[model samples]
Each structure stands twice: as C-alpha cells, then as structure tokens.
Target: MATKTRVPQTIDAYLAGLEDPTVRKTLGALRTQLRKLLPKATESISYRMPTFKVDGDAVAGFAFFKNHCGYYPFSGSVVPALKSELDGYATSKSGVTFPPDQPLPAKLVKTLVQARLAEIAARGKKPAAAKRKAPVGRPATTGFRVGVVRTLPMTAPELWDWVTTRPERWLGPGATLKAEPGGQYEVPKRRGSPGVRGEVRVVKPGHRLRMTWQPDGWKKPATLQLTVMPKAKGASLHVHMEKLPDAEAREAMRERWSKVLARVA
Candidate 1:
C-alpha cells in the first residue's frame, strides 16, 4: 500500500508530528538555522512542506522523508554552483539530499540561499548561454569504480549488522549510526588525516548498503556499495566502490577494499 502524505497545516506541526526523535532533532536544527539565517524571510507551509519566502517570493523550502531529507533552492541553478561544498551528500539540479539526521551545515545552507539570491538579482541582461536552450535533464555525475567479492560464513542479517555497526564496534565508545539515508557512515580518521569519512547513500536492511567514500586526500567523491546475498548455507558479500579518479586511485581502492573484504572471512 502507498503511504499517505500528510499535508501539515503548519511547519511546526509537521516537525512536531515526526515520529523519529532523530528526525525531529534534525529538522528542528534546520528550522532554527533557517529562521536565523533569513530573519527577514517569512515562514509558511507550501506544497505540503516548510517554505521560507522573501520579498513575496519563495526562496527555499525543505522536506523530510523516512530514509533521507532534502532542501529546495526554489531554482535548479542554485545547486550546481554550490556542488563543491556539498561533498558526502547526493544532489540534483533541483535540490540536495542529506542524511535524515544530518541536516545541512548552516554555512552551506547560507551559501545555497546566497547563490539563489544572486541568480535572482542577475535576472536582467541575461548571458548568451542562458539564452540558449538548456538540456532536458541533469547529467549523471555519480559513477562506479571498484568492486570486490567475498563469500562469508555468516547469514545476511549478521552481515548487515556487522557492516552497519562497524563504526561503533571498531571506532570505540561514543559512536553510533545516524541511521538514515544520507546519514553518516563515518570511519575513524587517522594519522592527522581524514581516514574514511563517508555518507550512507542507501540502506536496505539485510540486503544492500551504499554510500559515498572520499578518503582523506581523494580528488573526487567515490561511491561504495555493500550487498549481502543470502546463500543456501551462508551468504556472499559483494563490496563495490566506484567513481575513482584514475587508474592509480582505482588501484588504491582495490587494495583498500581488498583488505576490508578480508574481514568477511
């Protein structure tokens, strides 16, 4: 059955009605920051989501979901300009998706709004490129790079728990998963360098998990997928990481993933 989308009469009610405590906290932080950042902007519920309007025009809006959350720039062009700062999250021309509990950084949000406002401010004397016809859809910027397979003597459920709970188990105390799409899948940093800080892209329990993997000094954000296929006896673990920058990077990932996959034994 399709889940019903409740159109909250107000943004407060929408945030209040959120069943997930983590989501409530995340949205609360975002709401507070948005209000502070755009004090002059009026708040209203639009299209069944929280929208902030300025000068009688909608500049931005945000919505929540079970696995992830996204923000609207009120325009497609705004996102592309701020892509570099939006690392570790999935983004589209229209908006950006961050982990449900990992609301966007206040600075990034400010930048996004600033970019949109600038774009709006320059509406006159349009550039020649702006005058030309644009493409139908956004190009796919995310891609695959390396994959490694391993047959584990563990059930799918066990494998799921093992991988998702790795940070807490391996990193030590005070560690826990953000537990939502776009949530943190951060590995502990090391040697004064960011070791393996990434974001969880997808989490299908006992079956599949995906995320972005940008090691400390990588040039681009690579993708990672961990799949658990239940076999008759145990299960097979397929670990794939992609979008590596070059052959050298691919080789490094192959070595890295190979070592990680070795743990499956």
Candidate 2:
C-alpha cells in the first residue's frame, strides 16, 4: 500500500516537516521576521503555505521548494513596486524567490510587509468599484508609463550578455549601450530621419540597469530600468519605461517590449 504524505496543519508543523535543514532554517528566520513585523497578525496554513493575515487579508506567506524558497506578498503590485530592491532574486507579480542558503535580509522583509500594510490601508480609504465587468487586455497606465516582464530560459549572466551585446535586438539597428553609469549611447537614424540618444544612470552587471531614453523630437528623456532576476529555472527580464507622452505611446512601447521578449524567448 502507498503511504500518503501528511499535510502540515500549522506553521510549526510545516517547518518541522521540511527535510532540508537549510530550507527549515531559512523559513524559520523568515517566519521570525514576519512575526516581528506584524506582531498582531494571525498565522495559519493558507493555500498550502505558512500565511500571515492582517485584518482578514492574507498579507504574506512563505514556502520551501526543492531548490529555492518563496516569499509571497499575496498582492500582485507589491513585487513590482520593490523590483529595484529585488535585483538578485526571482520575482513574479505575486512572489519572490531566494536561495535556501541565502535568505532575504531582515530589512528587506520588513519593507515588504510594510508595503503590504500600506497598500491595504490605502485600499480601505478608497471607494469600491462598480459591479460592471472590466475590459480585457487593459493596459496598466500611470502617467504614461509602460512596464513589461518576461521569464526567459537563460541565466542572469547569460541574459546580461545577450542584451548588452545585441543592442539592436530591442533598442534599434546601429544602437549602442555602454552599460555603465554616465556612459553615453545612441541609436542612429535608419530609414527615415530622427534618432535616439541617452546616458546610462545605473548599472549592476547581470542584475540591473537604468538609463535615460530620448528620441530626436522629444524635449525630455524617459527613464528606463531593466532588471534580471534569478529563478529556479532561468531568469526574468523586467523592462520599465516611464514619462511617455500618452496612452498611445505607452501601448506601443508595451507591445514593442512584448515582441522583444518573445524574440528572446
């Protein structure tokens, strides 16, 4: 007869059942941090993970996997808000993953919890939306910003080289990126007329890069940030460009980045 695996009914049982000592210790530390951050938050097994709830809302959760551990914020927007701080970890819209041996810092975990708390508090102040259904393929627009995220099959270092060396793949033909703070780059005029130019503002090789982007006709440059996050399988590339002129520009950039990601994938 086959034996059934016991489900953990409590956080303690979940930690106790973990076979890997590193995973156990890592999750144990994470639990301690969450408890300290949310002293009054209730704990339980929610969605098969150790969850922390505040005011009946699932604010945080943690789980161990075969090769990595995950910290779920239980909110779609939190991870993206903290993407800059989460350079070395794997992140989706809802969760961030770190190596079992290298747990997230206490400060970072506190920031995550605080962000969720603030989000919940803000939501409480706002009026609820109507019962009408929403449209599909709706673009997330905030001041004409465009953000795109894609998980690719390559590692962080591999992606860093692939993108930095092949600037034309996304930027344009005859484009260049020096990949250093204050380094200048340009995209030349190809078929018609105008070109684009900018300077790199920040660079963390194989992890993150930030720069300015201005076309020939634009008066002000937009800010562009690209982050490569490590994952259990490969890595995720996040392309965020802001200060676009309008929704049309935002949608166009979104589609452009989507195509870039698909090509890389």
Residue 241's lDDT in candidate 1 = 55
Model 2: per-residue Cα lDDT over 161-265, one tens digit each: 887788887788888888788998899987864688999987777877778888888888877777776655787677877778877766667677779888879
Q: Let me know the TM-score candidate 1 reaches against the reference structure.
A: 0.46
RMSD of each: 19.0, 13.4
Off by over 4 Å in 1: 1-5, 124-265
Error in Å for residue 106 of model 2? 0.6
Shift in Å, residue 254, candidate 1 = 35
Can you write out model 1's per-residue Cα lDDT over 1-265, one digit (the tens) per residue? Answer: 9999667888899998889888888888888888865678889898778999978778888888778888998886567545557877799989898887577888788667655554443332235575564455643332434455555788888877886777554333344565569898565665544666677767777777767777777777887666776655676666655577776776666666567667548
lDDT of 2 at 81: 65
